[model samples]
Target: GGDGAEEEQWSQPGNDLSLPAVNQTKGKCCFSLCPGIKIPKVMDFLPNILTINDSSLPQARTRCLENGIGYREKCFYFVEDEAEWNRSETFCRSLGAHLATIDTWQELRFLLRYGGSLHYWIGLRREGSAPWTWFNGSLFNNSFQIRGRGQCAFVNGDGISSDWCSLMKYSVCSHPQTRPTGSRRDPEVWNLT
Candidate 1:
């Protein structure tokens, strides 16, 4: 007989598999599939997902107070109306803002959770043959594949994906939330600056 004690992979009759158990401490957990078999901790295999620190950036200051939510140095607004990508950009500009540019999984998750099931046109686009870039000049780089519908980027539950720029969809906007402080009637006394 060859190697006699080689472990085999099999599933139990009614067990549902799940991710490796995690705890409050970012340390190892005794994850085991069988009576005597054990696998290494989740942190050892995937440090990026398991051990990212909270953002240190300050909260965003948005111009509008009605529908903006602050998160990690930016205020986000979800435009409920469905419109083409260009139209969405114009709408955001009208509000003194730009389409929301997602910078982290936390922001992405926040949008998805509140966006319902509608695909949202974000600020990512490709210029002719150039790579996808945000309207705010940030580069769009991620593990998600940027193929298939290869022109515009939209956000959904699965993740960001490229789509036809002409397709109408809801959009997210970001901008400074700060408003000018002054009395409306006293125009001459109010400092426009």
Candidate 2:
């Protein structure tokens, strides 16, 4: 099963995050679960929350161009190289983005049309029987039905489908536009110096 196999990738020997000892750990806080988490200097490049809506489509499109397409409130970038679900997401995170997160039917429609028949790994995935969640740990609103039988999601002419997380496929990476940099809401996790 993908259980330990996929986890091994993140826990390779000497990987800083898996160091067991807290003092030896070097990764940033897991912000997806840390609401109001301030992004550190190293993570400044990561897209901050930008409020986008129906009126912002054109600007969003303009910002996402030359590399990907923008529809609705988010920008979608298609990565041509094939990678497993987790690796694909990690690749996106390195670029200061996450895998494409579909927020509505319109965005989903645009992605399906843009991708046509190609299989592109998206950010949605699940563990065991848990409900689907984006890479950031947000629950999928279940706005659209997803088919197939796996832990990771991909989109094509057939619509969204779940598949083995280990399957290699072209992936989509996306991000929100820029926002002002500042401290996280909590005082415990200080801003990175």
Which candidate leads the pack in TM-score? 2
| Cand. 1 TM to true fold | 0.55
Encode model 2's per-residue lDDT on 1-193: one tens digit a residue: 2222111111323222221111113324444433333234224422321222223222222256468666665778899999999999999887677899988788888889999899999999999889999998999999999897789999998799988999899999998764222212222222322
Question: What are the Cα lDDT values of the candidates?
Answer: 0.63, 0.67
In model 2, the Cα lDDT at residue 104 comes to 78
Q: In angstroms, how far off is 174's CA in candidate 2?
A: 0.7
lDDT over C-alpha atoms for residue 174 of model 1: 82
Clashing pairs in 2: 38-184
TM-score of each: 0.55, 0.59
Backbone N/Cα/C clashes per model: 7, 1
